[model samples]
Target: MTPVDTVDLWVIPLDRPGDETRTAPHLDCRESARADGLAPPRRGRFVVARGATREILSGYTGVEPKGLVWRVGQWGKPYVELRQDTAPVPAFNLSHCGAVAVLAVLRNGRREVGADIERVVGGRAERLVERFFHPDEARYVRGFAPAGREAEATRLWTRKEAYAKASGHRLLDVLHMPVLAPRPGRRPGRGDGTDTGAVRRLRDVPFDDGWAVSVAVMGSADFDVAPRLWPEGP
Candidate 1:
């Protein structure tokens, strides 16, 4: 496991050929039931996402992927229920969009982390900005060139999403949270409606084409985000 100062980000391709066949065997009964509830394409994606989550967590915990137990929070976030004797129980969060899934793990200790990925699509941003985004963030997206609005909106959306997940709050509840560094000297967190006392750090994660990714970590100090492709070694 890595140090708490670094958050490991794993990029997983949900539609990769043969991934489902290989990872399906590791799903617990609950995960299997959830996967079974989904329709095609989505079902396949769910299987790949959860299965890969197990495989990735297994690397750090030494627990077989299927053996890892999960508990759900009141807000619907999933937590890995490790033994009290376990030396390092990593905090993690996962998000997926289109064909890609991203997982963030803060290893060697419990530190809240969240990740979000979204396909860059046009036209959806304008209305979402009007309804969900904080005024400052909406202005930021609108300030972008007409052609750049969608990408900027996607970036802002991912940041808001990552922050929500990191704080274990619902998206709608935190939709008013401003994620941008509003002015030159100002940082993004305080006065952004964060009721949680933990300080939040947000950053954009570089990944493959057609996707925008971002990660959020809650701590007083900043943490480096180490990104890597899934099914690959440390």
Candidate 2:
């Protein structure tokens, strides 16, 4: 887990995030928990995510995981208070959906990065498309179905979530914004540097059979995604 990796990411199961690797520190859960009185699912997942994140960060920072730390977001996004003599300038975002949580870290002068992954549950894809996807995107999604449609749906959902996550907001009130679309040969993830196509054929991101993973980058000349995974059951 050296720092030379290309915008590395770690997707850990909220249910069972094993020993913390210290790539990051789980510094947000306690405050969020007390403020919101988390639901069972959120509590469990958040705890595991925190433990692992802390462990990960510890490995990198040599900082142990036994303290109260605050990861306050300016306007609800990650922000760090600059300490004298410390050059704190890197970009990252955290997102969790269903039972999994992801930590995306970007370095080497990457300004901003966002990532999202969603399971293509039964009708959730179509329903979300109708409810939020841009109109033309809806039609484009219609061109595919239970067969080749997964990819499209995954792309839409991931793009949507990536933006929301990037903006430090959830999707509850984001439907009014413009929808995202596919540009062939675009970077593998949702964001990167792909331009939205004409007619905006972005009715929900295409979904793969197992999961839909999308990422986006804003205000950057070059952006990309590097993926990491941690399974729940050993």
Pick the lDDT winner.
1
Tell me, what's the RMSD of every candidate? 2.9, 6.3
Question: Across residues 137-227, which tens digit of lDDT does each residue of candidate 2 receive?
Answer: 6776788866656566666777767766555555765454554434533433223222343111111223335677765555433343556
Q: Model 2, 12: alpha-carbon shift in Å?
A: 1.4
Give the TM-score (vs. native) of candidate 2. Answer: 0.68
Worst 10 residues of 1 by lDDT: 184-193
Q: How would you encode candidate 1's per-residue C-alpha lDDT over 148-209 as one tens digit per residue?
A: 88877887788889988988889988788778865632444433336756578888877766
Q: Rate the local accuracy (lDDT) of all candidates.
A: 0.82, 0.55
Regions of candidate 2 where Cα sits further than 4 Å from its true position: 1-5, 17-29, 32-42, 59-68, 82-84, 108-110, 148-151, 169-208, 229-234
Report how far residue 204 has shifted in candidate 2, in Å: 12
Off by over 4 Å in 1: 1-4, 182-193
Top TM-score hit? 1
Local error of candidate 2 at residue 176 (angstroms)? 4.8
TM-score for each model = 0.90, 0.68
